[model samples]
Target: MLLCFMGSIDRFRETVPLAELEREGRVQTSVDGRALALFHHEGEIRVVDNRCPHMGFPLSEGSVEDGVLTCHWHHARFELSCGDTFDPWADDVQTFPVEIRDGSVYVDPHPEPDEPPAEHWMRRLEDGLEQNLRLVVAKSAIGLADAGVSSDAVVERGVRFGSRYRESGWGPGLTILAAMRNVLPDLADDDRKRALYQGLVHVAGDCADAPPRFDQEPFDTEDVSFERLKAWFRENIKVRDADGAERVLRTAIANGADDAHLAEMLVAAATDHRYLNTGHTLDFVNKACEVLDHVGWDHGDAVLPSLIEGMATATRAEERSSWRQPVDLAAMVSETFADLDSLVESGAGTEWSPPASFTETLLSDDPEIVVAALEDAIREGASVEALAREVAFAAGTRVAQFATVNEFSDWNTVHHTFTYANAVHQLARRTGARELYRGVFDAAINVYLDRFLNTPPAPLPRPASSTETDLSVHLDELLDSFDVEGEVDEAGRRAAHYLDCGGDVSLLRERLAESLLREDAGFHTYQALEAGFTQAELRDSPEEVRTLLVAVARYLSAHFPTRREREQTFTIAARLHRGEKIHEEGQ
Candidate 1:
């Protein structure tokens, strides 16, 4: 009788006879259903997992020399006494305790684990991130998942890492992670890992070439007035004094300014320059806040100050010729700012609900009318947050209705407006600052300018157009629609059909995520999906949700069928994760 002990107790199971093992030089046996190879190395029996760590090739076929075991498949060498690999990529093989007694060889199939799951994977994650090894990163994600760690945990790790390591502050990688996190709930369990893996890989790429960020010291004073700190922060940002701004911001936090207070200061400064860097500064601030929302504001020391570089040094829209062109849009926005305070006071505490056609009016061809309508809303007692939500939705319509016939780059023109408005809306909701109404107006103007990209707006998927009831079928059709070019409208219709027929929202979200992840998706592609889900939540009517979803589908479809090189890289990662022999020729 033979048995292997597991679960903290050591029990031995029989393998081949010791004489037979020495004669053959190696023996293959299974104990507790785990295949192990016993080798006669240096006149002693050594046992190891039969499968190679590199590619699962049988270790019995490997040769031993000078007490070193080498996997024949990849020629990876390991010290026989332990499982440590000589080659880093090969990874360490798993070894078992072996004993020879009564002319027979036995193994303790279960021994102490090498390391806790978290410890090993976290180390591998750092290795993966530091080395920019996509395969290693993928394996870390898989390993962590197997250990029952939440996807959020992985994402937060990436956030902290990307935020800390990159001297450039927040950029596409963090934004991409934030966007992916925004839609994380919409993804299936497996896809969630894929999404996080994608996020981590991008962060690695972003920080690989970038300099590391060093923390700036806060002002010595621990007790400063909020008004004074706010004023100082805004002033430093205005003059592009990043060091001074970081000091001001850090000092504010040092003085115990709450999250809302910090948001208030950032909001005022972000709008001070009239859409800083095509509204990216505000969006960056918003994303910083957003990421903090996930990872906790206690990370403010690391997270919030990073916004300093972007905000202080960002180019203002007003500085651009486009904002001052034939329309003199810059002058027009300033004029609105002039009247903003008085207008907001007139509607103080009176919540003026926008008309049903409010979004349509915001889409007016005339920037003048768009701003005027916003002023009217403010005078009608519309709160800054409410107006911002309306403006953001209107911006979403620009992307939802974007025409593919235009120069492809135009998608970003509309995309910047949508994400900017979304950011403004999020901040307004948080700070409830009447000052942020400036962003609302700026967004509406952008919407007005972006009108032609939708000159012949892609027709919204006809309402309830499909009678199809099977949810799975809808998801299949929706995903299949992206295989070829020119499936934009088809994708939109399928998404509409899925949502309109009371199909599971989660299912729709899952399919949308799957479709997006499969392609060589761009930054804006991620924005479209996340923004759609976010904007959808803000609307009361189911129809509004449908509109946003269709917009999401249309945008993704319009950009579908990319080279998908990323997917191939992910495939290799997945194969390695399963410990499959990826090296065998045609096997």
Candidate 2:
């Protein structure tokens, strides 16, 4: 097929036979060296350049079915309505209009005029919005799935397959379904309304089809998908577009949507992800505080404490040098609360305190405080897991910075001490607190010595050795130095002697205890003694502890009689300084 530009509609009408061409199913034509395919269906005639947009395939040879002309070579379909290719990979085809008048059908060898019908324009807008809704729902569904919700669960929650109007104007149809509880009072209780709101929030940006780019952050220009669009919307929500902002706001308000709510939701979503960047988070916090002060939630007295607590949580997390920081959730929450407070302060209305216990418990730093707060928040309709995680994170940060075993032990004195203890243990492992950990392990072993007496402590794994030192001999020498025959608890006395000899007796004594308690105690006992002697020598004179530790670790591993015990011995020895308990039973 070809593009036959017959000058103008009038000139073309006079030249071509309008009636005879319509009677024929197809017509072959040419223009500009390109072949063309012309066909009539239901009184409407379409003329398209015959080449497939994806590849140079003949359209005349293709089949016309269901208002689509399909290429025979690649099955690329072009819609006769728009002359646009249906294949996602294909480009649009060139279409020309045909008019039938008198006895002739005239093919206007020119591009169709840009005169879109009113209905077509409306359909275009509606279709774009519908496509956006589908994209939102699909993205939200994936996010919910990731968050451990099944597809069946989402459906059960009343998220039917339909679109809903969101204040933000960018959410899925599911959001509209959720809002129906509010729109239709007799549908469900206020409790359902709240649930729906939360569900809508959960899925709001869950299925963003594109990734977002924050201010000043570089974005990949090529992958501008739905996610990117939402991101751009979020980043630019507060920015006033001189030409359209007023019109957009006026239109939304006229449609019964709250303009302020839309703006706030946009800000909330944008700020949520970027809140950790100090500059951005602080800005939101300050704005939230201002809102609170204006509304009465700031109550003067409540503001500082809230800000301090929130900032403290942020600062602690920051100080720990963690790769991923908390989302400054506390700050976000504080700002939100402050906003509510402002409403009351202005006498617009008294905002319901989000359950006094709820606020107190969530803002607390203590695990017990958090637990209590979580329980209260859960009862008061807050996300229990989310609040619990927030508290856990704050407590974890403090535990990571603990310098002494006493601090860790003290922190565990409260109820629900396991969480704190676990945190302490994790921090101990991370910090390479081998010596301090040895002390803790020794203390534990001492408490359970009788129970472990019959069972041999598992062997320590051997480490890769860089030196050829005979660690066994060195241990034997250290053991020989101990006056096991003395009246004193010889083990303790020996440990003191090792200490005096400049050994890291703290770790050595723990290792010795572990070795004695386990079945493969012989080799580990020997290595522990050797390590102790080496440590002693290094401390008392001009030797390096790294050399000794590395050498002893390797030697014990090499000489181990059993491969099973070898790795055990080396690992235990390597982590001797780390606070992991030496398991008496083998895995």
Candidate 3:
């Protein structure tokens, strides 16, 4: 043993005597709570952090041979002097400066400083995205969150990366990113990071299989007016010319069309064909606007262009016989369009609420009746958003009441309709464009198309059904129900009871996120949960919230307990973050 003192980067403190270290070939010691490993390889004494960067295994127990130190636990090898890991999964270990003076060894706890925390994490994020390493991305998310980096900054990186990388344009990954961003305020601190992590991880994965995006340049002249450009853009979308639409869109942005105008243009084209792409086109357009809100309209060049491909190529509902036949819901929606401007003008200056049975008529079996009721509401002073909101509320009941007897994929039928209606509701609130109101009509018709999903409507979780007063108990019951397959009705009952007992909405939201994130949830699941929170917030009644909550619960429960490979990967990331000894045996 030797008395030791440590100094800054320029100096080193004495550790064990060189003679004893030479005899043993290696030694471990603690200084300032850090486990330091001293290795006598060749003629020099080298020092490094004893803990493995991957899982906090004791590297002192690892083997050093020929200037390479390998952790036996996972066989991660690092350079003896610089501590660079040969394995990317195992991050570089911290190596300290070593000196020898007067037959004793000295070590400096600090090494040359690297980049700033935020910059380092951002760089790590880039690497993670590029490599599609889920664990690496998870660590980057955790690091960024710990460094107090706002999700806005993190999301900007993801959007730019995804846009530049995925040739297929905006996919579920970017939607998840934006949707998760929308719900962050409702999540707990840890769940917030998880949400960001899930978004980032999905982005990396979504881009992995696709080739890089090659954006086309703006048109040669910036002489196009907004109206002319909008016309050309919609025309291009109608013809399914993605390249032409991209060029026109790029022209619009270059000619100074801001996000609001850009969104209106998208909504107009999206509604032109009535529920395009089974509602994904509209839903995706809505998400694009959302992501742009936080990442900035300045990024419209990168973020907005990605949506052109989805828009121009989306499948129009008119192509489906189900929408065209048995009711011609498509034409019904189109007929209402002619009167939209006048109806919207008539409703001006009047705050509107749904007629008591308006949504019921929208949900009833008759498509004509549904269309007539919507038009009637507009005449009776129902605003575009008020109409869209009730339509979305009725759409929620489809999910809350969606029958288990239907084939499992039918959950998505009602799920798609609700999300589409909610997207319209979201857009309606953003701007009062008369053309955008077409989506309200399109979405209502979609809900009408999905009426059979409620054939044997699942019992609504009656609010007062549960007498349990403890919110935590209700939350626990909700989670436990998810552990079983098809506990859909039970899950809804639990959430309904939680609200009945006056559970905090935010806390309930956090619990929902926890449940969803705990499994291998899908893209639509994220959308439903986030959209449910937003839609529920607009309504003043507990009953409305219950309906939304039950809808989300059943939707989530129906898809619960996926292999959870994603959660397993996330758990590994969390353990590494906590410096837990993951490689230890006999726990």
Provide the RMSD of all predictions against the true structure, rounded to 1 decimal.
2.8, 26.6, 2.4
Which segments of candidate 1 are over 4 A away from where they belong? 1-10, 23-29, 42-44, 54-80, 86-90, 465-467, 563-587
lDDT of 2 by residue, 328-386 (tens): 33443334344433322343322223443442243243333433333343334333123
Error of 1 at 24 (Å): 4.4
Kindly report which residue stretches of model 2 are placed more than 4 angstroms away from their true locations once superposed. 1-9, 13-29, 32-35, 39-46, 51-58, 65-68, 73-106, 111-587
Cα lDDT tens digits for candidate 1, 202-229: 8888889778898878889866789999
* Model 3 clashes, total count: 0
Better of 1 and 2 by TM-score: 1
Q: After superposition, how far is residue 37 of candidate 1 from its true place, in Å?
A: 3.9
C-alpha-based local distance difference test score of model 1: 0.83
Clashing pairs in 3: none
Task: List TM-score per model, in order.
Answer: 0.92, 0.23, 0.95
How does model 2 fare in lDDT? 0.35
Which of candidates 2 and 3 reaches a greater lDDT? 3
In candidate 1, position 396 carries an lDDT of: 84
By TM-score, the candidates rank as 3, 1, 2
Q: How close to the true structure is residue 565 of candidate 2, measured as C-alpha lDDT?
A: 40
Look at candidate 1 and tell me the lDDT of residue 111: 88
Count clashing pairs, candidate 1. Answer: 0
